[model samples]
Target: MLRQAQHERVHEGFAVEAVDLVKEFGETRAVDGVSLAVPSGSIFGLLGPNGAGKTTTLRILLGIIDPSSGTRRVLGHERPLEAAREVGYLPEERGLYPSMHARDAIAFVGALRGLPLREGRRRADELLEEHGLGEWARRPIRNLSKGMAQTVQLLGTIIHGPRLIVLDEPFSGLDAINQARLEELIRRQAREGATIIFSTHVIAHAERLCERIAIIAQGRVAFEGSVDEARGRLRPIVRLRTRSQDGSWRSAIPAAARLHNGEWVFELPEGGPEPLLKALIDGEAGIETLAIERPGLHDAFVAIAGDAAAEAMGHQEPSE
Candidate 1:
């Protein structure tokens, strides 16, 4: 038991790592030179547009398919199949037997992942009850609502207590309330020492849940860093609201200040905040509220990838 538990810890500690990953599907290059790592107890986010190689990259990591080039390790095992028992994966394309009850569907997946049928059934019951689906456990999956079915699918994925969970577009059918519930569930899993890597196009989920994220565009890695680190790269623009009578502030305002909606929108002088604040105190602008208009990860994504995201989906925007 000790050896097995220790091995599980080791596998969870360095749950996933990849280097120079590339994959080609005949005529098209699906993934190109991507590298990333998901450390234990952290929620790592994979972000990209529809054809940006996110699915191919995840397929390689999960061992569903091998990369054309590069290397990856999961659960401390070089072989994906060998590590399968310790990893739970929720694929973007969901599959559940429509005629099968929710409990049976979950137990089936659990058994396939190496859990004893009895233990798996016990867990399925517990989870169904916990997720407020106890009343529907015996109902066929085809009878459940789409969101409820998705919730059940996720619960099944983790029923066996896998050390690392990889979720692909997990919020697809979930409503806002259930989405928040899933995010909290992810946080709880991280607190319990499980590493999670989830793919999503939603920036808010990535911002709220991920400690670190890797942005992929055009089948390649555009950026990889912590959420705060990503925010630090952009020029911090602060909008200061002030009035003419405020002689107490003058020198500290940026030279590019413009009055809009009763607020002065200007880039926080690259010189730094201390000097900016010092100057504000001496400026004639009656400073009301000092608000930093930060370019969040979403903004960075747009800046780095241009309109490829929207364009890929066949949408056009008005000229700037």
Candidate 2:
């Protein structure tokens, strides 16, 4: 399958690169010294809370807006607009003529990206049918439901078969079912060899979709690496329930261990659990239950971005 090939394919160079990008609006510095390198044919995520400058950074990378003092390259072009034909962008603010037919709207967007009008129309129909919107092809944008209209805009975004696609909050305002569908669509696009970069405050989506991510907080990058690497910032947790309330087994527990609801929880010991388990057994500490739990993305995010940023993210999506 194409996805298999994509996994096997060795990426040579970055599809997009930005160096110390800084965007300022008068006294407000929106993006401060942000840098990123998106691998070719990879799904990269820009994760942060609202007003964290993710949108400003994306705009700077795409040349939609100029940075105060920074440089960026898109698809190997020093000037992002020079490679406009190979890139597709979906802004945070969704807009389409309300009176335009769905097919026509998509075709028009394709035409802006250099796709021939006739071919664009043909591809629009094919995309609509493939996505279960064939019957609504001729429907006016104003008449379509919010989800349907958003779907139409998404279809239009990819109609040109762009090499690099940038989406700002792509899952915002989407229903659960439509959000799942959008996630699949993003995966399919990556499978087809497109480099996808999307910004979202919802950590769950980023955790599931992106191999590498940049966590932005207060206009600065807090962390940039693989998901596993981010999670590795905190040690795995150990939860234990002991039959004996007081014994030598308590000595084996770390000083930081805390008892909550009859369970002793603490960070995993550095030397490994074998010694601890043996100590528990040898000390006559009847172990009712013992489990090692790895820290998840949310824990990592809280560790990296601090409680305030995590609270901002919490308002948008539930953490795992």
Candidate 3:
């Protein structure tokens, strides 16, 4: 609900809107009629498995590659190239030169993005120091671990404080502490009025980090919405793990999909969770450990994505 509301607010406010976007490399269609609305100053996640057209979409959005067909509006402008300078992109599968120092590597990246050499190094030193990597200032990138390299890459992306931040798998190789730090950074950036597009395969992290997510699978969006709405799509499954009355309590399993182990698990039909809870109590089974285990975004993702992949192989169109 918040994501949709944010989407509506952004549609009225921001200039970055992707409409029916399509991309192809040779004969293979990587992105198929994908449409997404990313509002400025919000954290939008583009999530999917490998080869789901996520990186390709970001590349197209960045003007690194042109879309086969479709349109994107950034800051009320149609030129993605001009709009690109307004963006900061941290790619997923890229590497720094092995011999370069961490700070130098980052400074070089910033320079390529139009930042002056002196200013780029200045910002790089501040960011590295801020992240407790002051000691790693002169350390070679080859000597740094994967997590440290990831931090350096992240710093490079934001040294210029671009209006929009596009991060591909920003959480990869990051420990819990760094992940939390990255989350904080994202929130801070959003508060500063910068739109952020974060791409990752880690669903739970995305669930916690993003206000809106466009889940792509097999070159298409499987589900696109807020976490709450994604969970709302699933039926409420009540797990009653109480002291079973001689296991005979399963006889009152609503005359449907019976009990799972000691807990009665069944999909909530109509109405909502209240009806299901009331029914469990009315079935003469005392609910000592009553909990409505709402299916997470993972369930929604698997269900939606699996269906989408099946449909794609079947030569069918995207399903709801």
Top model number, TM-score: 2
Off by over 4 Å in 2: 1-11, 318-320
Candidate 1: list runs displaced more than 4 Å. Answer: 1-13, 245-252, 255-258, 310-320
Q: State which candidate, 1 or 3, has the greater lDDT.
A: 1
lDDT, candidates in the order shown: 0.80, 0.90, 0.75
TM-score, predicted candidate 1 vs. hidden true structure: 0.89
Off by over 4 Å in 3: 1-12, 242-255, 273-283, 307-320
- Which one is best on lDDT? 2
Q: Report the error of model 2 at residue 19, Å.
A: 0.9
**In model 1, how many backbone clashes occur?**
11
| lDDT of model number 2 | 0.90
Please provide, for model 2 over 1-320, each residue's C-alpha lDDT reduced to its tens digit, 9 standing for 90 to 100.
12223234426699999999988899999899998999998899999999999999998898989999989999888989998987889999999999999999999999999988998889999999998999999989999998899989998898888888899999998888889989999998988888999999999899999989999998999999899999999999999998999888788899999999999999988878998999899989899999999998989999999999999999978423
What are the C-alpha RMSDs, in order, of all predicted structures?
4.0, 2.9, 6.5
Error of 3 at 188 (Å): 2.7
Question: Positional deviation of 139 in candidate 2, in angstroms?
Answer: 0.8
Clash numbers, per candidate: 11, 0, 0
Error of 2 at 109 (Å): 0.8
